[model samples]
Target: MYENKISARQLRRMIFIETFGAGALSIPAFACYKEQNGFWSLIFYGVFLAGTIAFFIIFSGKISEENFENRKIGKTGLARNVNINVSKMQTRLKSINFPEVLPQPIKFVYMIRFFINAVALFYFFGKTIQTVYMPESSFLFIIFPAAILLCYSLYTTLQKRARFLEIIFPWIITTYFIAVILSFIGIEKAMQIGNAGELWQGILSDNIFRSMGNGYLMLLCSSPIEFLLFLRPAAEERGTETKNRKVEDKNNKEGKNNREGKDDKAIRDIITAVAGAILCNVLFCFLSVRTLGPTLTSQSEWPVIKMMQLIRMPGGFLERFDILPIIFWILCMMAVLSGYLYYGWSIFQTRSGGCLKNFLGITFVCLVLLTCVVEKHTLLWTFYLKYKAFVDFPLSLILPLVVWLFKRQKDFNYQEKT
Candidate 1:
C-alpha cells in the first residue's frame, strides 16, 4: 500500500517537516519554557511552530522544482525549455564556490560536538523519565536500546515514505503540538507551580526573550535534519525524469542542443543560508522566553522546580484525559529519534571514509553514557543552569558566524581569479 502511494515531493516534506522537530532536542525547549513561563506560554509557542511550518512549505516547493529541473538537464545531457530565475539554491551555492562537492570529514571536533549533545540529552532524558515517569533500575539498558531503535527506525522510515520528508514532518509537528497542549491540560491543578500573576508578568517581560534564544539553539540540532529531509523528493523527482529522458534521447536531441542559458550565482545561496539561520534563531528566542523561559530552568530538576512545588496545575478535565499526554510523548520521542537517526545514517552513507564519522559516533556514545552516569549520581546537579546557558548561547552565535567567514574568503578568491 505504501509503495504505490508515496511521491518524491511528499518524501521531501516528511524529512524536513517531521524529522526536523524530533524529540531528543525538543524536550529541552519544552522544559525551558515550562520552567520559565508556565503553561499559558504554549499558546505563543503554537503560533511560532505554525509560522515555521508555513515558511518551510513555501521553500520546499521552490527547492523541489529546481531539483526537478536539474534532473531533467542531467537526464537529457542537454538543457531544453528551461526558464532560469534567481533561486535560494543558487544563492546558497554562490557562497562556497559550491565547495567542489567534497567529502565531509567527521573529525575530532565533530565527535566532541556529538558526544556533548548525546550526553546532555541522555542525562536530561533520564532525569525526565525519573521525575515524570518511573525510575528505571538500568539507565544504560533503557536509553541505549531506545536511542538505537529510534535511529534505525528513522533510517528505514524515510526510505519507505517515498522519501518525502516534508509530508512526514508536518504530521510529526502537528502531533507534537497536540501532545504538548494535552500534557499542559492534564497536569493536576493541585500540581500547578508558581503564582499565576508572577508567571504572567514573567511571560511578558525578559522571560520571553530568553525563551526565544533557547528556541534558536534547539533549531541548531534540528536544522541539519531539515536539510536532509528536502533531499528525498528532490532525488525521486530527478530519478523519474532521468528514466523518462533515457527513452526520448534521440528525437529531441537537436532541439535540446539549441537552447540558451544564463549564469547562476552562488552568493545568493550563502546569504539565504545565513539569513535562514538568523531568522530561525531570533524567533526561537522570543517564543522560548514568552512561553517557557522562566519556568524551564525550574521545572527540569533545576532550582526553580524545587521552589515551586507549592503551585501545581489543576487537573480539571485533563485528569480524565490522562492517556493523551503519554501518547503525545511517545509520538514526539519517535519524531526526535527519526531525525537523529536519519542524519547519522546519511553521514555514514555519504562520508564514511574519514575519521570524522567514527569520531562523531563515538563521541555521541560517550555523551549518552556520561548523561546516564551524571544524573544517576547527581553530578553537576547544582550548576546545571550555568552549564546549559554556556552550551546554548555560544553555539547559537557560532554557526552563522563560521558560515559567514567561509563565505568572505570564497568571495575574495573569486575576485582574484577574475
Candidate 2:
C-alpha cells in the first residue's frame, strides 16, 4: 500500500479532473431542471459539500488519534474492536468481500452498481467521440481502440496514473478556462441581438424546493467526492514519515506538527478541488444558457459542445477553434473513464493475480459486451439517472453518518472503561 501511495497533490488533481469531466456532462440536465437558477444551485451544493468534507476529515483525524492512543495504552476493548471492524470493512469494500456488518445482499447490489457505472462511463465516452469527432465512424470503431487503451492503462501503476494527471492538470485547466472565456463571445453576440438579459430571466427560481430537489439529484450524479473513500487512504502526507533513525527522537514533535499541517493541507486540497470543479460546472452552465438561450440548451443532448461550436476564434486564426476544446474535453473524458474502470477493477482484487484476475477480466469483457448490446443510449442514461439516487444517497451521505455515529458510541464506551 505504501508503494502504491499517491501524494495529496496528485489526489487533488485526480479529483478535479474526475469531478470536472463528469459534472460538465451533466450540467445541461441541471440547467434544464433549474433553468438559469442552476448556477445558484451548484453554489449551494458546493458549499454544503465543502462543509461535509471538512467535518469528515476532522473527525477522521480524531478517530485515528484515538485509535493510536488506545493501541499505545494496550487497551484491546470495545474501541479496539470497533476500530478493527471498521478497518476490516474499509479493506473489504476496497479490496474484496462484504464485511459481516453489512448484509450479504448489499455485496451483490454493490457489484451490480460498479458494473453499471463502468458501462455507463464507457458508453458515454464512445458516444461523445462518435457524436463530436467521428460522426461518420461506427461506434465499434471508436470504442474498440478506447477499450484497448483503457485495458493497457489499468495494467499500469497507480503512481504513473497520478503523475500523468499531475502533468496534464495545468493544460486541462487552461484549455477549459480558455473555452469558457471564448464562450463569452457568444454572449456578446446575443447582446448584439438584444437577448442578453434573457440570461438572467430565471436566475432565481420561484419554486425553491423543486430547484433544490433537482440540484440534489444533480449533485449526487456529478460530484466525485465518493472517490475519496478509496483515494484518501492511498494519499501519503508529505513529511509525515522519515527514514533517518538519528533524527527520529529530535523530529518527533516536528513530525507531529507536520502531520497536523499536512492534514490541514489535505482538507484544503479536497475543498479546493471540489469547489473548483463545481465553479467550472457553474460557469459552463451559465455560458450554455446565456449562449443557447435556455430553451435550446435544455433540448440539446450535449449543450456544452453546442455552445463551443457557436464560439468563433478572434481574427479567424482558426476556422474551427471549437476543435481545440473538443480535443481537450476528449482527454478529460478519457481520464474520467479510466478512473471509473480502475476503481471498479480495484474492487475485484485484481492485484492478487491468478484465477481471480482471469475471472475479473472475463467479467469486464462481459460488461463491455453489455455496453455494446445496449442499443438505446438514452435509456441507459435514464436508468442511471433514476437508479443512482438509491446508490449514491445511502453510500455517500448515510453511510458516513452511520460510521461516525458508531465510532462515537465506541469512543464513549472506551471512555467509560477507562
Best by lDDT: 2
Residue ranges of candidate 2 with Cα displaced over 4 Å: 34-39, 55-111, 191-201, 237-239, 243-256, 313-316, 350-355, 376-378, 401-418
Q: Largest TM-score belongs to which candidate?
A: 2
TM-score of each: 0.49, 0.77
lDDT of 1 at 291: 36
For candidate 2, what is the TM-score?
0.77
What is model 2's C-alpha RMSD? 7.1
Q: After superposition, how far is residue 242 of candidate 2 from its true place, in Å?
A: 2.3
lDDT of 1 by residue, 1-418 (tens): 2332234345334443333333332434453543544233334443444444444443333332221122232322235335543221111111111112222432232334433444555566555555554665566655776666543443354446444343344455465455444434433342334587876666575466655654544444443333322332233332444444454444334423321110111212322333443343233333333333445533543222222232234543333332333343445444544544444444444455533435445544754666666776665653554554575335423433344355456556877996
